[model samples]
Target chain A: MTGVRRKSGSVPVSLATVAAAAEVSISTVSRIVNGQTHRASRETIERVRGAIETLGYRPNQLGRALKRGESRVVAMLTANLNNPVMATVASSAEAALRAAGYVMILCDTHDRPELQDEYLKAMRSQAVQGYILVTNVKSPGLAEFVARGEPAVFACRRNPYASGAFVGIDNVGAGADAADYLWSRGCREPAVLFPAQSSSTIEDRLAGFSMRLLELGGRCSKAEAPGLSHLDVGYEAARSLLDRASLPQGVMCLSDQIAYGAHRLFFERGLRVPDDCVMVSIDGSTLSSWLAPWLTSVRVPYHEFGRHIVDLLGEIWRGEASGERILPHAFQSDVSSDFE
Target chain B: MTGVRRKSGSVPVSLATVAAAAEVSISTVSRIVNGQTHRASRETIERVRGAIETLGYRPNQLGRALKRGESRVVAMLTANLNNPVMATVASSAEAALRAAGYVMILCDTHDRPELQDEYLKAMRSQAVQGYILVTNVKSPGLAEFVARGEPAVFACRRNPYASGAFVGIDNVGAGADAADYLWSRGCREPAVLFPAQSSSTIEDRLAGFSMRLLELGGRCSKAEAPGLSHLDVGYEAARSLLDRASLPQGVMCLSDQIAYGAHRLFFERGLRVPDDCVMVSIDGSTLSSWLAPWLTSVRVPYHEFGRHIVDLLGEIWRGEASGERILPHAFQSDVSSDFE
Candidate 1:
C-alpha cells in the first residue's frame, strides 16, 4: 500500500502487478483478492494479500459493476442541439438525470443513423444503465437493446418499433388547433409549409391541419421545404410560393424555426402578418416571441414535456410502467387580431 | 466464465465470485485480475486464469484504467445551452474530441457555481482525462484541479486564477466596432442596453463602447436589464429608455438575445430599425438575421473559437503548449449601409 500510495501520481497498479509481487499463480491471486480462500491455503492468501496492500490498487467502478449489472450513467441521444427546442429538452433531461443520481452523457448524432449506432455501441460497451432519446427518427440497434430488457425512454419523439415509455405533445391535436384558428378567422385559402421528412410528429401536424382545413371548406396547398434545416426549408418554400400567381390567405408552419424563416421572407416581400396573410406554427420555444411579429403557435408544452419525460422515466426505472404519456398543446394568438 | 455469462443479464461477476470459483485468496485474485502476475508462480497464474474463464468475469474499462490513472472521457462544462453560440461551440468541441478518440460528457452548470463544483467532483470521481469550460465565471475546485497538473481549457470565457489554455474573442474590440459603426452613421447620442452581470466580456464591451463613443464626441447612456435573462433585460431597458422625453439616435445592445427583447419593445412602440434607431449587438446568431430588418452585430468568432479551443486541447493533450488564443471579432453590418 505504501509503494502504491507513493506512486499514486503515476500509472495505477494492476492485478498482475500484485500477483508478480506475491510470488503466486494469477488464479490463486484472484481467489485471494476476491475472498474465495477455500481453494487457497492460508499461507498463500497472506502473501497475495500483502502484495495487494503493498501495490495500493483499487477496483474500478466499471469492474465493480460487473457484479451489479448497472452503471450510474445514462446516455442521451439527440439528433442535433442546433435547434433551440432540442436544447431545452436536453437541459431538462440532464437536470432530471442528475437529480436522480445518474450522470448523463450526451451524444449528438447530427441526424445520422450511423453515428447513432456508433454512440449506442460505445454506451453499451460502457454498460450504461439506460438511454434517453430526443431523436425524431428511428435509431438503428435501439430496438435490439430495448428488446434485451434495457431501460429506455423516448422524449419528444416516438419509436415505431420499441415498446418503451414516451413523453410527447399531441402533434395532431396541435395541428388541428392551428387550422381551426386560421379557418375561423375566415381564411378560405390556407397553405401548409412543411419540411420534407417522415417524422411522425411533422406528419401528424400536417395531417391534422389539412384534414381540419378541408372540413372547413378550405383547400390547403402543401409545399415541401427542400432541406432538413427548418429555416432553410421555410425560406425556400416561401420563395417558391411567391412565384405563384396567387398566395394563400393563411399559412401553417410546422415549427417555430420554419415560421421565423417564412416570416423573414414575408417581411422582405413587403407583406405584413394578418394584413396580407396570417401564420400559425408549432413548437412554442421562447425564441418564438423574439421575432418582430410574434408567431401564433401551438405551444408544445415543453415544460410539461420535460416533467412527464422524467416522471415516465421514473416509472421505467422502478419497473412500474412502460407506457405513453401524451401531453396536451394550446394555441397562443400573438398575431394581429384584426382580419380582412 | 460460464457462471458469469449465465448471470450476465442479472448481475455482474465480482472479484469475490472469481476467487471462490478459482479456490484462491482474494488478494491473489486481485493481482491476477489486474495483470500484476510477475510475482505469481506459473501454477498459481494458471489456476487464477482458469477460475476467471470459468466465472465469465470481464474487467471493465475503469478497472483497466486503474493502471493508467485516467479514463478516455472528457467532461465539458457549459454555463447554458440556450445560447446558440454555446450550442455551436459544443458541437464543434464534441467533433474535435471524438476525432481524437475521446468521449465527451456534457454538463450544464446553468451558470451556477454550485452545479459547476458538483459536476467537477463527479468527473474527477469518474477519472476523466480533462475538462473544457464554457463558463464566464470561475468555478469552485477548478483552480485546484488545474494546479494539480490536470489538463483544462476555457472556451469563450476564462478563469482568472488558472493559467490554463483559453480560447475567446476580443470583446473590447468588438464593442469599439459597434460604437464606431453607430457613430460613423452620424449618431450624436448613443444608448446602451446590457445584461447586468459581472462577466469580463460584458464589462470590456461596455467599456470599449462607452470610451470610444466619448472619444468620438458622443455621449453614451447605459441601462441595466431587469433579470439574468438577456431578453427580459433588453425589454426592461428599452421600456425605461422609451419613457424618457427623447431616445438616443443609435443603440448598442450587449447581445443578440438582448437585442431581440429590445427589438420586440421597439416594434410594439412603432419604432422601426434604421428609421427610428440603428442598432448593433454581439453574437451573430442565426436569429440575428431571422428578424425583420436583420440586426447588425459583432459576430462572435464561434467557429474560430471552437477550432482554437480544440487546437489548444490537442497541445495540452500532447503536453506541448499551455497558452491562450484570442481570436478577432468582425462586425457584420446589416443594419443599413447608410451608417457611414
Candidate 2:
C-alpha cells in the first residue's frame, strides 16, 4: 500500500487511494471517514486515519451516500415545464421538498416518451432517493422502477398502466363542475376543446364533461387537434369548429393555454367572448386571472399540491400504503361579477 | 483481509467485502471489477474476480462514476420556475443538454440567497460536472465556486459580483429598443414599470430606458413595488401610478407578466390599451402574442438560448476564455399591424 505511486498528476486523491495506503478495504476507510467506526478495531481505524491524512484524500459526499444506499435527493420528471400549470406544480413541489430537507432534481421530459425514458435511466443511475412524476408517460423503465416498490408520487398526471401514489385534483369532478356551470349559463349547445394526445387527466375530464352534459339534457361536441403544445391545439381546434355551420354557445377549454389560443383566434375573427360564446377552462393558473377575457375556470388548487405531494412521498418512504389524494377544486372568475 | 465478516444481514455485500475476501485493496477490487487490471498482477486480478463471484457484488453505477470523479450531469439553478421566461429557458436548456448526452438537474432557488447557497453546496457535494444559473443571487458559496474557475454559464441573468460566461440578450440594448419603439409611437411622456427587487437585468434595462428616453427629450418616470412575483409587482405599481393625478401616454413593462398584471388593472379602470395607452414590454413570450390587447414587445430569443448556453459551457470545459454571448432581439407585435 505504501509503495504505490500516484495514478497521475491530473487525478485527485480518492477514497480508493486512502484504502490502498491503509491496507484496508474501501468500506472500512469510508466507515472511518464518515465517523461510523464502531466495527473497526482501534489500530485499524488509526491506520486508516493516518493513510487518509497522508494521502490527502477528501471523502466525497456523494460517495458516502452511495455507501449508505440512499441520497437526500428527489427527482421530478415534468412533461412540459413550459406550460404554466406544469411549471406551477413543479415549483411548488420543489419548495416543499426543499423545506423537507431534500433537493429536487427537475427534468423536463418535453412530453416525449423517449426523453422520459432517458431521464429515468439517467436519474436512476444517479440513485435519486425517490421520484415525483408530473409526466404520464409509462416508459418501460418507469414501470420496472415502480414495480420494484420504489418511492414515487404521481403529481398532476398519473400512469394509467400502474397503480401508484397520486396527488392532484379530481379532473373528472372538475370537468363535471365545468359542465354544470356552463349549462346553468343557458347554453344548450356546448363544445369542448382539447388536445388529441390523451392522458388520464384529459380523458377523465372529457369523460366527466360528456357524462354530466348528457345527464343535463345537453349534448357537447368536441374538437381536437394533434399538437404537442396546448396553444397550437386550441387554435387548430377552434378553427376546425368555426368551419362548421354554427358555433356552440358555451365552450370548455381543457386547459388555460388552450383557452388563450382559442381566444386569440376568436379575437382575430372579431368574435368577442361571452358575447358570441361563453367560455370556461381548467387549470386556474395565474394567467387565467391575469389575462383579459378573465377565464372562468375550475381552479385546480396548484399551490397546495406541493405540500401534499411531499407529505405523500414521506409516507411512502415510511412503508405506508399508496393511495390517491384528490384535492378540492372550485370555480373562479373575476369576470363573473360583470355577467351577474 | 478474509477475516472480515459480512457487515450484517441487512446490508448488502459491498466492494469492501469483495476486497477483504480477495486479500487485496478495495481499489484493486474495483479496478478488476471495472475491467481496469493494468496495475494489478494476474493472480491479484483473478483473486478479486473469484471473490466478486463468491460475494455476489453488483457494482453501483453511481459508485463507478465517483471513482472516475466525473458524472455526465449538469445542474441548472433557476430563480423562479413559475416564471414563463425562466421556464422557457430551463426547458430549452434541458432539451439541449439531453441532445448532448448530458442530464440536467434543475433546482428552483426561488430568488432566495440562502436557498441558492444551500443548493450550491448540495450540488457541489454531489459533484455535478457544471452549473447553469438562471438565477442572479450572488451567494458567498457561489462566489467561491465561480472564483475557483468552475464551469458555469449564466443564462438570462448575469452575476453582478463575478465575471463569468453569460448567455442572454443585451438587456441594455433591449431596453433602448423598447424606449425607441414607444417613442416612435408618438409618445412624449412615458413610464416604465418594474419589480422593486432589482437584478442586473432589471437595472441595465432601466438604465437604457431612462437614458434613451432622456436623449429623446421625454423624461421617463418609473414605478416599482416590492414583491417576489412580477404579477404582484405590476399590479401594485400600476395602482400607485393610477393614484396620481395623471397617467403616462406610453408605458413599458420590464416583463410580460408585469404587463399582464398592469393590463388587468387598466381593464378594471375601463381604460383601453393602445387607445388610452400605447404599451411595450420585454419578453415577447407566447402569452404576449396569445393574450388580448396583443402586447407589442421586444422579443428575446429564448428558444436559441439553449444552444448558445450549452456550447459556451462546452467551451469553458475546454479551457477557452469566458466571454459574453448576446443573442439578438426584435420587435414582434401582431397588434402593430392593426395600428398601422
Candidate 3:
C-alpha cells in the first residue's frame, strides 16, 4: 500500500504500516491503538507495540472516537486559564490524558456562572467522556450531570453542591501553615488578602490563616477584592490597606497573582518584603520565586493534582469508590525574614 | 409546548418554546438558529427573532454540527499553555470566538513536533471549522491541511512549510525597539537570550535586534537555549552569563518566561537590575508589571491578535483574500533605569 506523501517528500506514519508490519488486520491495530489491549492476545499486542515503536505510529484520536458512544475526549474547565497555577495543572492534566489515549479540551469559564453552564452543555453534547473542573461552584447543570452518574472531578476548587471526586491540595492546612510560619518570624499584625467572592478554597484558607493567627496572640485583618485576576485586585487591596495608618506586619494572599500585586504596591511605596511586611501566598507558580523579594508560598502539588484526577477517573471507570482525594501542599519561604 | 425542567425545578429555555411562541415550524426555528436566515422570509425571520428574544433560545451547536460538515468549533493549538502570554492570547481569542458563536478548543501541543502533529490530526478529524496555532514550525501534516483549502491561521509563531494567514505582533520591530530603548538608556554591551529553535518569529526578532544593536555601534552577544519553556532555560543561561565575569550591561530575552528566570538568578546573585544589568523581554504579561523590579517588555497586542484571528478566519470562510495580519507592539520600561 502506498503511504500518503507530503509536498515536502516525507511519508507520515500510518496505522496501515503498523498493521502490515505486525501481520495483523487494520481493525486489530485500531483496537490496540484505542486502548483495547485486553481483546487482543498478548502476542498480538506485543507485535503491534513493536510495529508501533518502529513506525512511530501516532493514532488519530478522532477516528476511534467516531466508532462508539465514547469520544475518548475529556475536557478540563477552569475559571480562568490566565492563572499560571491553573495553566500548570492543565499542562499536567493534558499530558496525562494524552498518554492514556484521550484528548483534553481546555475551556476557560472566565469565572462566569452562565459561561460554566454554556460550556458544560456544549461539551456534554460534543460527547466528552469526562470533565475536570478547576473552579466549579453550583454550576447550573452540574447536579443533573452528577445525577446521571457521569464521570467528573473537581481540581483545586470544589463545588458545595456536587458530591464528586476532588483532587487538590489542602488549602486550609496551607493557610494555617502560612500563619505559623509568619508568626514564628514575629509577625503579629497579620492580614489576609483574598477575593471578595466567597469560594470554599479561599474561605478555608482565610479561616485557617485568620483563626491560627488570632489564636496565637496575633491580630489578623481582612482585605477583600472582587475579580478573578488577582493582580489588579491585590494591588487595589494593598493600596487601601497601605492608606490605613496601621499597616499589617504580615500579609497572606490567596494566590500568587494577588501577592505579585501587593509586591508592586509595597515596592512603589518604599517598602521591602519581609523588611516592612512579610508576604505569603498560595500557588507556588514560577513567578512566585522569580521576583526581587521572592514570595513565601504554599506549593500546590499541581503535577500530582493532575495525575490524581486522571487516576481517580480511572478508579471511577473501574467501578471503584470515588469521593474525595486530597493532595498535600508544602510551605516554601523566600521572604528575607525566613532566611534571617 | 412544555419546557424541559431541570433538577433545580427551573425550566431551561428551549428552541421548542421559540417555535411555539412564533407559531412557526420547528424546522424554520432550526434553520434560523443555525444562521441559515437567507432561506426564510422577512416576516418569518422577524417572528423567530422576536420569539428567540422572548424565550431566550440558546441553540444546541452539537446537533447543528452533526447536520452539516461545518462545525461551530475552532481550535487553538499551542506549544504550552503554562506560558502566561499564551494564556492571555487564548483567553481573548476564546472570548472573541464565543462572541461570534464559535466554541474554542485549546489543545496544548507541549512543543513536541509529534504532539503538534497529533493534536492537528485529532482536532481536524473532530471536524473543527478552523485552527489557530500559537507555535508551529514545519509540522508533518500542516502543509497538507493548508493545501486542502482549510481555514488555518498562525498566531505568535509562523511556519515556512505552511502558507496560511498569520496573526501576531511585529516581533522584528519589537526587537529593534528593545535594542533602541536599551541603547538610549546607556547600554553598550547587550546580550540576547532566546530559544534555540529555528522558528521564523524567534529568528526575526534575533535578526532585527542584533542588526539594530550593531548599527547603533553597540556590541550584542547571543545565548540560545533549546526547549519549549523559556524559564528554566533563561535561568541556566543567566547563570552561565553571570559566571563569565564580563557580563552584558543589558539582557534582552525573547519571552517573559525567560526574563522571569533571569530575574531569579540576578536577584539570588545580588545583582541589581538596571544598576548592574538591565533586563528586557517580549510578551508583556501580568508578572512583568506586578513584580517588585518589574520586567521591561514589548507588549504584544494580545486582544487585537485574538480578534484579528477570528476576523481573518471569517474573511477566509467568506472567500476573501487572506495572508497576514500584523498587530502593533509597545515597549514597556520597568527596568528602573528607564524611570531614572
lDDT per residue (tens digit) for residues B96-171 in model 1:
7766766778888877778887887677656677778887366556655555666778887676575568888888
Error of 2 at B137 (Å): 2.6
Q: Evaluated on chain B only, what are the TM-scores of all the candidate structures, in order?
A: 0.78, 0.81, 0.83
Q: Give the runs in model 3 whose Cα sits over 4 Å from its true position.
A: A1-67, A139-150, A333-340, B1-63, B146-149, B292-294, B333-340
What docking tier does model 1 reach?
acceptable
Model 2's alpha-carbon lDDT is 0.81
Error of 3 at A69 (Å): 1.8
TM-score of predicted structure 2: 0.84
**2 or 3, which is superior by TM-score?**
2
The parts of candidate 1 lying over 4 Å away from their true place are: A1-67, A292-294, A333-340, B1-60, B333-340
Question: lDDT of model 2 at residue B89?
Answer: 92
Positional deviation of residue B38's Cα in model 2 after best superposition, in angstroms: 15
What TM-score against the true chain A does chain A of each candidate get? 0.78, 0.82, 0.81
Rate residue A181 of model 1 by lDDT.
88
In model 1, the Cα lDDT at residue B84 comes to 77
Question: How many angstroms is residue B42 displaced in model 2 relative to the true structure, after the best TM-score fit?
Answer: 21
Per-residue alpha-carbon lDDT of candidate 2 for residues A237-271, written as tens digits (9 for 90 to 100): 99899988478899999988888878888988989
Question: Which of 2 and 3 is ahead in lDDT?
Answer: 2
RMSD of each: 9.0, 7.2, 6.5
| Residue B214 displacement in candidate 2 (angstroms) | 2.0
